[model samples]
Target: MSTIVVDHLSKIYPVAVKEAGFKGTLTHFFKRTYRQVKAVQDVSFQIESGEVVGFLGANGAGKTTALKMLTGLIHPTSGRVEVAGHIPFQRRSTFLSKVTLVMGQKQQLIWDLPALDSFKINGAVYGISDRALNHRVGELSEMLSLQGKLTQPVRKLSLGERMKAELLAALLHEPNVLFLDEPTLGLDVNAQVAVREFLREYNQRYGATVLLTSHYMADITALCKRVLMIHQGQLIYDGSLDRLVDRFSPCREVKVEFARPYSAHELSVYGDLQDVEKQSARFLVQQEGLTGAIAKILADLQVVDLTVSDPPIEEVIGQLFQAGTVAG
Candidate 1:
């Protein structure tokens, strides 16, 4: 069943516009100008229980705005959103207790106080008994590898440690759905891996539905098999990651080394020459032409070695963004 449902959900903001300089500012002060910005428009998707879906977009693409609406922090400008079987914008206690929103750049932890104190506060807000609070905190702390660090002041901990602590605090209430924005942002490689591993294990252990957004593709690549891509405040892609690649990327990369040196222009007939060196050249060949291109190259040129491979995931996604339209 779908635990999170968004039906034509959209958010629009009326932003004030102003001109530069003295005369323009005086005119603007007398006659104010405003523009209606569609932060999210006609966005709709459904998330099944226990499904971890990646919400992906460049900055200002409305990923965060959609998340805020889903978590009940902000109401949508139009359409409907249901999370955990309750209307999100209503902010009822039942709805609030069933979902948690965690933003990596924002901190819920008290800077000067120990994370334990903050955990207790969260428990209080959720009406969790002391016994349950201790048990839940212990479980989350163990999962995040923060058994001994939870007592330390948040400010005293390392960046990675503080992030782990923040995660533990968020999960202390045992919410069924989590909306995480940039959950692994700014962490070192090791820290990023740690968080990824922990999230995977936590999801498996608890069957929690997670909707995550991150600039680090590693976070999405490792954690989400399905992804939702928003572009220009609209949901452009909602499907498996593999399918997204196949839908948008029609070309594969081919690299070859000739026994003799060849210039890029000389090899242009074979494929779209991407890089050329003294003895090696790379080409982007359409999937349907990959076989014919390789055959023609081998038959006509003195080939030393050759290999064909899929383009990088990042490159494929970049092409999608540049195209600015979803595959029909």
Candidate 2:
């Protein structure tokens, strides 16, 4: 069953008009101008219970705005948002109790106190029973390898350790719906992998529905089977991660190394040459022509090595944004 439903959800911010000159600034006090910037526009998607979904977008693409709406941190200008059978913006205690949002740049822990104290405070806020809280805390600390670090003040721990503590605090109540925005943004590769593994385990153990927004392709590619991609405040695509790649990227990349420098004429014989160097060339060919193009290139030239691959997800998304801008 769908645990989250968003129907035409939209958010708009009114931009204040400010003039540069002194006279213009004085006049603005009497009559001010406002422009409406639509941050999220007519976006709709359904997420089932226990599904881990990725949210992809460029900066100013409204990924964070949409997440805020879902988590009730901000209200949408229009459209319905139901998460876990409750309207999020209401900020109902029961609804809030069952959902958690973890942002990488933001800290909910107390800097002056030990992380364990922060968790204790959160446990109180959620009104978790002492027995239940202890059990949950123990499990999370073990999972995040924070047993010893729990006694350290948040300011004293490393970035990665603080992140783990944040996760543990957020999960103390075992919220059924999780919203993670750039959860591993500044961490090194090892830390990133650790966070990813924890998320995977947390989801499997609790059957929580997770919505993740990240710039790192590896984060989305490793953790999510489905992706919701947006651009310029509009929903661009919603489907399987593989389907997203397939739909937006119909052309395949072909890299060919030659024994000698190749002419444009010979390259054109294979496919559209995307780039060329002294001894090698790369081409973008439609899926249908890939096999024949490779065969012809191998038969005609001294082929040293060749590789074919789908375009990067970031590139596909960039193309989508370009197309949207042109359409508008």
Per-model root-mean-square deviation over C-alphas:
2.9, 3.7
Question: Which of the numbered candidates is closest to the native, going by highest TM-score?
Answer: 1
Off by over 4 Å in 2: 17-32, 258-283, 288-303, 325-328
Q: Cα deviation in Å at residue 35, candidate 1?
A: 2.3
Question: Highest lDDT among the candidates is held by which one?
Answer: 1
- Give residue 41's error in model 2 in angstroms: 1.2
Q: Compared with the true structure, what per-residue lDDT tens digits does model 1 show for residues 76-137?
A: 99999999899998899998889998889999999999999999999999999999999988
- Tens-digit lDDT string for candidate 2 (1-328): 7999999999999987888999889878888899999999999999999999999888899999999999998989999999999999899999999999999999999998999888888989999988898899889889988789988888999999999999999999889999999999899999999999999999999899999998888999999999888888998788888877776677888998988998887688788787789998988888988899889988989999999998677766676767664221
lDDT of each: 0.91, 0.90
* TM-score, every prediction: 0.88, 0.85
Give the C-alpha miss distance for residue 319 in model 2, angstroms.
Answer: 2.9
Clashing pairs in 2: none
